[model samples]
Target: MIELKSAGEISAMREAGRVVAGVHAAVRAQAAVGVSLRELDQVARTVIHEGGAGSSFLGYHPSFGATPYPGVICTSVNGVMLHGLPTPYRLRDGDLLSVDCAVHVDGWHADGTVSFVVGAARAEDLDLIRVADATLAAGIAAAVPGARMGDVGHAMSAVGRGAGYGMQNDFGGHGIGREMHESPFVPNEGRKGRGLWLRPGLVIAIEPSLIAGGGDDYHMASDGWSVCTGDGSRSAHVEHTVAITQDGPVILTVP
Candidate 1:
């Protein structure tokens, strides 16, 4: 069911989001060539605990997964799209890394992610990351009170389409609060003025994922978590937890 959060409750969620943001920042700083994904996960864990927040992602067992998530943060490298499990593999120069994270504080939850190149960044890879970031910003801008959910998706997808990029509708953002995942599924692509109506007190995560080449095609890895481009092309994912209020779309997870 869709839920609305009070101002005080939103403040609490913001706190959790701040912690998630700190984890993202700390992990981003730790990520570099020769760094293992597990090391980045360790950095996130340390920051989450130091902030006095509990990881909402650890041991998370989604309906589609047979095993619980083992990492505090998802470290997706290169062509790996989403849910890329951290492993011993060391990041190489020019590797595009996407990290997704969530944490709870004062009974509220917040989730966010970032994609960055390890050392030297390729022009196309950099552009893909820029698309993800810009699309997320546009999506958040449409998350105002009284707006339809479709506005957010349209705003996001339009950016992708205009840039000649492909969007993945199969997996997208969703409502987030006391739990990691909630209701009112937010797609990265959709028709304008359609879907659920937005309102005050509503909180949701706005994530836009795009593939370098155009299309909705994607493939799930054997790990049952990691997803990537079907054509083996590069991809990028960007996200933020936003709150719809009278003031506007408040991005709670900014670092």
Candidate 2:
């Protein structure tokens, strides 16, 4: 069921969002050439713990997951789209990396993702990341009180399509609060003026994932978690947890 958060609950979520943001900042700083994905995950774990929050990703066994997740953060490198397991794979210069992290504080949850190049970023990779950031911004802007969920998706997909990027509709954003995942699945693409109507206290994660090759097809990795582009093209993912409020849409997952 769709659960609207109270003002106090939203405040608690904001605190959790701050912890998630800290993890992103620390992971981004530690992500460099020669750094292993596991190292990055450890960085996130440390930050989450120091912030007095618990990881929502660690031990999380979603319905599709084969086992409980072992990492505090997801480190998707290059063509890997999402749910990339943190292994012993070391980073190399020019590698594109996307880090996804979620945390809970006082029972409220927040989730977000960031994509960037490790070192010596390629022009094309930078462009893809830019589009992903723009797409996320558009989606967050559309998430205002009185707007429909489709409006947010439409706003996000429009930016991706206009950039000639492909979107993965199979996996998208969703409501987040007491639990890391909640009701009202938020698609990356949708028609305007359709889907759930936005209202005050409604909080959801707005993530926009774009494939550079302009194809949506993807395949699962042998590890049973990592998702990669079928065409072997690079991808970028960016996200922010937003709350529809009486005044406007407020982004909860911000540093």
The digit string of per-residue lDDT tens for model 2 on 1-255 reads 999999989999999999989998898899889999999998888899899999999999987787899999999999999999999999999999999999999889999999999989999999999999999999988888888989988998999999999999888999999898999899899899999999999999988889999999999898888899989999998989998899899999987
Any residue pairs clashing in model 2, and if so which? none
My TM-score estimates for the predictions, one after another, are: 0.98, 0.99
| Tens digit of per-residue lDDT, candidate 1, span 1-255 | 888899999999999989989998898898888999999889999999999999998999997765899999998887788899988889999999999999999889999999999999999999999988999999999888888999999999899878998888878999999888999899988889998999999999988888887777888899888888887888899889999999899999976
Cα deviation of 203, candidate 1, in Å: 0.1
TM value for model 1? 0.98
Please list the residue runs of candidate 1 whose C-alpha ends up more than 4 Å from where it truly belongs after superposition.
none
Report every candidate's CA lDDT: 0.90, 0.92
